[model samples]
Target: MIHAYRFYIDGEWVEPCVPKTLEVIDPSTEQPAGTIALGSAADVERAVTAARRAFAFFSRTSKAERIDLLKRIVAILKRRNDELGDIISREMGAPLAMARAEQAGIGATHFEQTIKALETFAFDYMQGSTRILREPIGTIGMITPWNWPINQIACKVAPALATGCTMVLKPSEIAPFNAVIFAEIMDEAGVPKGVFNLVQGDGLTVGVELAGHPDVDMVSFTGSTRAGIAVAQAAAPTVKRVHQELGGKSPNIILRSADFSAAVTAGVRRCFGNSGQTCTAPTRMLVPVERMEQASSIAASEAAVLVVGPPSDPRTDLGPVASSAQFDKIQTLIERGIAEGAELIAGGLGRPPHLDAGYYVRPTVFARVTNQMTIAREEIFGPVLSIIGYQSEDEAIAIANDTPYGLAAYIQGDPEEARALAGRLRAGSVRLNSAAWDSAAPFGGYKQSGNGREYGKFGLHEFTEVKGIVGFLND
Candidate 1:
C-alpha cells in the first residue's frame, strides 16, 4: 500500500486532493529515489477531523492496552527493521550499516521505551481527597525533520500513541518514504483507524494547516529554530500547546583535567558521526588555550581517517548531506571558516577529490576559532568541527552556555567534576566523559532550542492534559 504515492489517512491509502507529487532525492547520487503525493490544506483538514473523531475512544483506553499496542508496534518494527533501513539509506544518504542499526533500529527502541514508560506511568491518583487525572491532549500535529528522520517520528508518534492521543504527522518531504512504511507498520500492528494519520507534503501546506487548525490540540515540531518559530506562531491563534525541539550548536568541552588526545579524538568522532547531521552534535569543541595545537592536530587526524564516500559503500563513515541546499550551506560555512581566519587544519571546500558526483562533504576541522566566529555560532549540520580555545573553566562554562540553543552539551573530564560542570551548563542534556545515551532520561532544551521534553515517561507526559476532580472524588 505504501509503495503507491498516497497519503495514509483515516487508516487507508487515499489519493491527494489534487494529484501533485514531489520527488525525493537520494543525496549520495543526486538521483530520484521516489515520489510522494504532496498534500494540501484539504488533506490536513481530513486527517485532523479523523484524529479528533478517534481521540475520545482511544484516550479512554487502559494503560495495559496501550502497552500491548506498543509491543506489537515494536515487534513489527524489528521484523521489518532492515527493510526500513534500506529506505532510510536511499532517501537520506546514511551509510547502510548506520542506517540499519541506528536509523531504522532507533524506531524500535522508541517503541520499546514507550512501552516501558507506559507500563509504569501513573495516569491518575488521589491527592488531598481530589483525583488528579492525566488525560490525553487530543489531535496532535507533528512536523519532523529529514535528518534522523525515524528518530523524530518514533519519539513523537510512540509517545502520542502511548498517551492515547491521535495525531496527524507531516514528515520531512526530503525523506518521506520511511514514514510511509512506518504507517504501514502501524496498520499491520492493528492500530485503530483514525488513531494515527500520515500526510505527505511540505511544511507550508500540511504543516501550517495542522498547526493552525482549531481541532488540533497540540503541535510538536522538530527542525530548524526558524521553522520551529513558525510552527509556534501558527499555533498561537488556536492557543494549541506547541512542543518544539529545534536546532543546536552543542558544545563539547575538553577540560584541562582530561587526556587531550583521548578527549579530542572522541569529540571529533562523535561530531562526525551521522555525517555530522545530528542536532545534538558537538559542533563546537572548547579546549584550554595551551592545548589548542594538540586538539587541532588530534581533530585533524580524526577527520582525515573518516571515509566520506557514497552511502552505498560499506566502509563509508560519513554520507552526503540530505540535499543540494544542505551541501551549498555547508560549503559556504566551510569557506566562511577559512575567510574568517579560523585555521583550517583539515578539509576546505568542495566534495572529496575521488568522488566525481554526489553531495559528500569533506570532514572539516577548524581550529583557533573564537565563540564569535560564524563557524562556532551556527549549527552547520555537517561533519565540521570548530575548535575554540578557552582560558579557564569559567570561560569554558560561559562559552558552552553562550548559544541560544541549549539542547545538549558534552564534557570530557573526570566524572565527578564533569557532573559539577554539567549542572552549570544551560543545556537540557550534558554527557560526561562520552557517556552512553539513556532513553529514559528527559530530553529537551532550556531556551530557544524549543520547549518540552520527548523521550520516555517525560515524552508521554507532554501529550497529556492534567485535570483535577476535587468534589467528585471523595476518599
Candidate 2:
C-alpha cells in the first residue's frame, strides 16, 4: 500500500504539524488502497505563508516565462499519463479505459490549452486612452472535489500558474493520490519554490483555515453547493474573491424533432458515465409527454446493457460509486423515487445481481417523474436518471429552468432547432445533438450552480485582477 504522510509545502514534502493520518479507500474493492496525512490549521498557515512569499515574485513573472513552465508540465504529464490513469481508476473507481482517455487526458488538455491561451491572450489593453492592466490576483486557496480530482486540479492550477499566481491547494481527501502525483509533476517541471503547495485534509480544519486565511487573496472551490456556501462564509471576514463551481441537477431536453431512440439512449450512457459522479451531469431528462413511454424504454434498455464491475476491467462501463456512503445515498434516493410514485424502469435499490463485494450500484432510470420529486430536484451524483414529461416546447423550457441550478443543459434535435432551443435554456453550458465538450469554451453556472468560469482564457482570468490606469495615459 502507498503511504503518503508528508504534505507538499514551499516546493518540498514535509511532515504535517500534527502527525495524524487517514486511510484512502479503493471504492471498487472496498479496501485500503493507501494512506495520507491529515493536515491541520498549522499546515495551512505554513502553506499560505509560502504562497504569499512567492506571490511577490511569481505574480510579476513574464507571460513568456509562465508559458514555458506550463509547456514543461504538459510534457511531463504526457510521459506519466498511464501511471496517472491507473492511480485515478484505483482511487476513484473510474473504469480503466475512461481513466486513461477522459480522466487523465483532460488533465494534460487543460495545461496545453492554457499554454495556447497564454500565447495570444492580451494581458493589457487600451480603452479610451486609459491603460487597462490585468495582473495576477495574488495567493489563491483552492479546494477541489474528488469526483473529477485531477481535472479540477489541473483546471485550477494551470490557470493560476499561467497567470502567475501562487496557490495552496487542498484536494479531496477521498481521492488525493492523483493530486499527489500532480504535485510531483509540478516539481519535476521546475516550478519555482513556494509557487504551488498542497495540504491534504478534510474541510473542517484545513479547508476552513485556507478559506479564512487573511493572507489569501482568492478562494476557488468546486464541490456541493452546501460546501461552497461554507467556503464563502469562511472567506467572508477577509473579503477574498471566492470562485465556486458547485452542484447541478442538469437537464437533457429531447425535442420532438430529434431521433427519439438515439437521443434517449445517448442520454442514459452520458448520465451513467463515471457512475454519474460529475457535477454537471444531465440527470433530469425531459421528453414530450406522449413519447415518455418510448423514451423511458430506450433509457432502460441502454442502462440494462451497461457493464457494472470493477473499474480495472476494460469492458466495465459502469463501476462502483466512489464510496459506501455514496452507494447508500443513491440507494436511498432510488427508494424515495419509488415511494414518490415514479416508475422504476431499469436498476434500483441494491447492488447489481451477483455483485455484493463493492460499492457497486445498479444503473437505475425512473419514468413519469414529476419536477417536485426529490430525485428530479436534487443532485444524486449516481447512475440514476429521472424522465420527466413535458407537454410543449414552452413547458420543456420551463421545467428545465425550474431547478435552482443552471450549470449545464443538453438539447437533442436538428442543428438549427437545437441551437435555437439551447439559447432559451438558463444554463451556462448547453450541448447540441451530443456535441463534443470544448476545452476553450468558458464553463460555470448562471445561478446557484455557482459563479466564475473555468477553461481556456476564462479560467486564466479567474486568477487575475483588473486595474485601469487612467492618469498614466493622459488624454
Taking every candidate in turn, the Cα RMSD to the unseen true structure, in Å, is: 1.3, 0.9
Off by over 4 Å in 1: 1-3, 472-475
lDDT of 1 by residue, 410-433 (tens): 999887788888889999898999
Q: What is the lDDT of candidate 2?
A: 0.93
- Give lDDT: candidate 1, residue 396: 95
Summing lDDT over every window of 10 consecutive residues in candidate 2, give the lowest-scoring window.
466-475
* Model 2 CA RMSD to the hidden true structure, in angstroms: 0.9
TM-score versus the correct structure, for each prediction: 0.98, 0.99
Q: How close is candidate 1 to the true structure, as a TM-score?
A: 0.98
Candidate 1: count of backbone clashes, pairs at least 3 residues apart or interchain: 0
Candidate 2 error regions (>4 Å): none
Q: lDDT of each model, Cα atoms only?
A: 0.91, 0.93
